[model samples]
Target: MAAEKKTAIPKDIVALSFEQALAELEAIVARLEGGQVDLEESIGIYERGALLKAHCEAKLQAAQTKVDRIVVGADGGLKTESAEIG
Candidate 1:
């Protein structure tokens, strides 16, 4: 069998909650914008920032999918039915 491919993302990054990831991403953006980091460090931070952004987006999508389902009534009024979470 082919060797399993390891993920590029660090475990720490993967473990971070959505809020934490977003905060880190914002800090990375600030550092990049400040123009103080050297080229190599900047590149590394940029990569991490990209990963953080992806993590945040994924968290948002998951939350959206988990939100309560809305239904339309026969009388044209809106109703919300409890969404079944799997």
Candidate 2:
């Protein structure tokens, strides 16, 4: 009998830090770019990469919101600026 592979749960992603998720995403990109992985493996990696990307984005957005809440001015007013910055 062969050992069964465990399916990844949503909580697994929640547990991963932004850095760890980004690292995994980079590895996935490198593997796909190398053109060595088969179609099925590539698809699986792509899916995982997408999830990691979303998780990273969410973390970044949350951090940005936290930073934006702090206004740096003598008057102590809410800072209003372009949310999308290059």
Candidate 3:
């Protein structure tokens, strides 16, 4: 049988939400671990997974930057402080 051509991942990878990207990455890992794909296909999926992982991380970092913690001032006033994300 002839080898099948590997298809590219769908468009707008960076546009995917953090959850979406993470889910896709998880699926890629499962597929890779399953060991059913040919080497070339595996390479393609691995590349896609890398992109997804990076996108997810960026989304998370952006979200972290927006997160804030409420603090009480000495005078009992409320203040918003950026939360540190590790």
- Between prediction 1 and prediction 2, the one with superior TM-score is 1
TM-score of each: 0.64, 0.63, 0.60
lDDT of 1 at 55: 71
Q: Rank the candidates by lDDT, best first.
A: 1, 3, 2
Q: Which stretches of candidate 3 lie over 4 Å from their true place?
A: 1-11, 64-86
What's the number of clashes in each of the models? 0, 0, 0
Clashing pairs in 1: none
- Give one digit per residue, the lDDT tens place, for model 1 in 1-86: 01112235578988999899999999999999999999999998988887787777777877544458889889999988888777
Instruction: List, residue by residue over 14-81, the lDDT tens digit for candidate 2.
Output: 79999999998999999999999999999988787777777787789875342233456788766755
How well does candidate 1 score on lDDT at residue 61? 77
Task: Please give the lDDT score at residue 47 for candidate 1.
Answer: 81
For all predictions, the C-alpha RMSD in Å is 9.1, 9.4, 9.0
Runs of candidate 1 exceeding 4 Å displacement: 1-8, 64-86
Candidate 3 TM-score, true structure as reference: 0.60
Better of 2 and 3 by TM-score: 2
C-alpha lDDT of candidate 1 relative to the true structure: 0.81
Best by TM-score: 1
